[model samples]
Target chain A: MDDLSTVWLILAAAAATYLTRIGGYALITRMRTMPPRLEQALNAVPAAVLTTLWAPAFFNSGWDVRLALIVAALVSLRYPGLIMLAAGWAAAMAARHLFGL
Target chain B: MNRRDIIDGLKGGAVIALSTTPFAVLFGAVAVDNGLSIVEAGLMSATIYAGASQLVGIELFGQQVAPWLIVLSIFAVNFRHVLYSAAIARHIRGYSFWQKAVAFFFLIDPQFAESIRRAETGKPVSFAWYMAFGLIIYVSWLLFSVLGAWFGSMLGDPKVWAIDVLLPIYFLGLVIGFRRKPGFYPVVAASMVGSMAGFHLVGSPWHVSIGAICGVAVAALLPLPQKPDQSAEVTH
Candidate 1:
């Protein structure tokens, strides 16, 4: 609530966040050789981690959000990043403003 | 150190920075609305630098959640960065200690994803390119957060512009970009199902790690790639 404590809390949270950011690298660096299964798991990290960002939103949100993500995924299949983003944004804006979803 | 790498990194990061602008602004606005002063909101964005966790931290802060609990929540929300840095260790291990330290600090979702992509594609993950990318996103993040805080109350509902959909869609794009990787389908499916279940049963932050662990477990269980010849008796 107070300024000092709020600052302290932010800094503490920052430290904890940094710990997560580096914790994996620190652990891996300590190892001389990595196991195959562990390498597989690490290779899987991108899809695994990034999926959580959207899957819950897709299953939980309204039609507008779902439509936007679907549109984005479709665009991504054929186009580049900026184009995919634009198409998704357009889809969402149209869904909400034009169709009132 | 190549000029081309700098240009490439800047161009790529600038696109992501633009995509992330809405969320930064949204976080800034929400932070202020939740009783954080403008400076406090900016500080959170500057220091934690993880968008989703900063949001969760601020939401709990607004609710007057315990300080330690808030820190723990940020840690939980950001736990995936551990996996990211671990996954990327081989690619950037050649960097100096200080470079790694600074690189790890800027290891946001996009940064990690892009770095992994670069490495897998055989491009050198030069520090020049890496920081060019990271710093662009970082600076824009800090700037827009403060801007959003400054204009917090003045802005209307985000839903009208559909600003809420951008982040999820952006992340969806990133997820789709990894479709060619081995075990992508099963892993994504497991994470999706696991996350949806966790979202219903558990809640935010926990769902991320829970789903991630589920997906990673599926990845571990899925058939290992058969490398040619004596791949050194699989040892854990």
Candidate 2:
């Protein structure tokens, strides 16, 4: 595609993405209040979305990645911050080097 | 816009920014590697400001996928933002139309997480704080993206340094932060299974939405043992 076409495509994608970000607020603001069940569901969203984002990659990758994720998960449970993330990365790199993955 | 609010907002943003910086750099390098111009990569990061979707877009662009398909795929990948908007709307109800517009444009996952956590804890959700969070992330992301594009080759392979694993690990930490909440495990389980299934059955990006929906469904059906106290922190 031409430069102009690529720019337009990026613009279109950005527009669509912006719409998703704003659309829910626009819709929800008109409603008086959210239902309790819906609220519960909404509350659960972060965990669910994060898991969904991570799980497929976790399961489909090689054992090197799996070991890395396992270390990350265990560290995250205890540390739950940037420190945990560093630990996970360190573990993955260590595994890759040691096992020649 | 008070001094304390500014300090707090910047503090919050700085914490997230530290975590996100490596990924943002990686994104720029990867985008260039995938044949995008530095300007194009920078523009996408500025406009889309979504790491996952932007990565997907670059991959699709490399494959010469149709423009509309790329847009549609990004929309699907980012559909979770709709839920984020809904969750945050209640807190920002008093903001004017334009203010809300600007806020929504910057509503990436980290900002959403931080903002929602604050609101649930009964902290005042000011426009300034929200904007600070967004602006800091936006500026840093753009800066790193450009740096990555220009010096990406010199940085060498991200995987060699294990930078590729950081995102999943960061996300895992975020998920773990919420583990104490009621019905959390079930929701997480549903999402994991649903996304894995979606990956095999449906394909790239759709799994995210599918998994989120599955999680929401399970959480909605399950009975809460106790009403969640808004002021209570989910123990880290």
What is the TM-score of each candidate's chain B when compared with the real chain B? Answer: 0.95, 0.93
* Worst-scoring 10-residue span by lDDT in model 1 chain B: B227-236
When candidate 2 is compared with the true two-chain complex, its DockQ is 0.59
lDDT of 1 by residue, B101-147 (tens): 99999999999999989988899999999999999999999999999
TM-score for chain A as predicted in candidate 1? 0.95
Each candidate's fnat: 0.78, 0.74
Name model 1 segments beyond 4 Å from true: B228-236
**TM-score of the second chain, cand. 1:** 0.95
* Interface RMSD list for the candidates: 3.0, 4.9
For each candidate, the alpha-carbon lDDT, in order, equals 0.89, 0.85
lDDT of 2 by residue, B1-236 (tens): 46677778888888888888887888888888988899998999999999999999988988968788999999999999999998787788667889988999999988888887888788878988888777888899989988888776777977889887888877777888788877999999999999999999999889999999999899999985575534322110
- List model 1 lDDT by residue over A13-85, tens digit each: 9999999999998888777777778888888988988899888878888999889988888889999988998
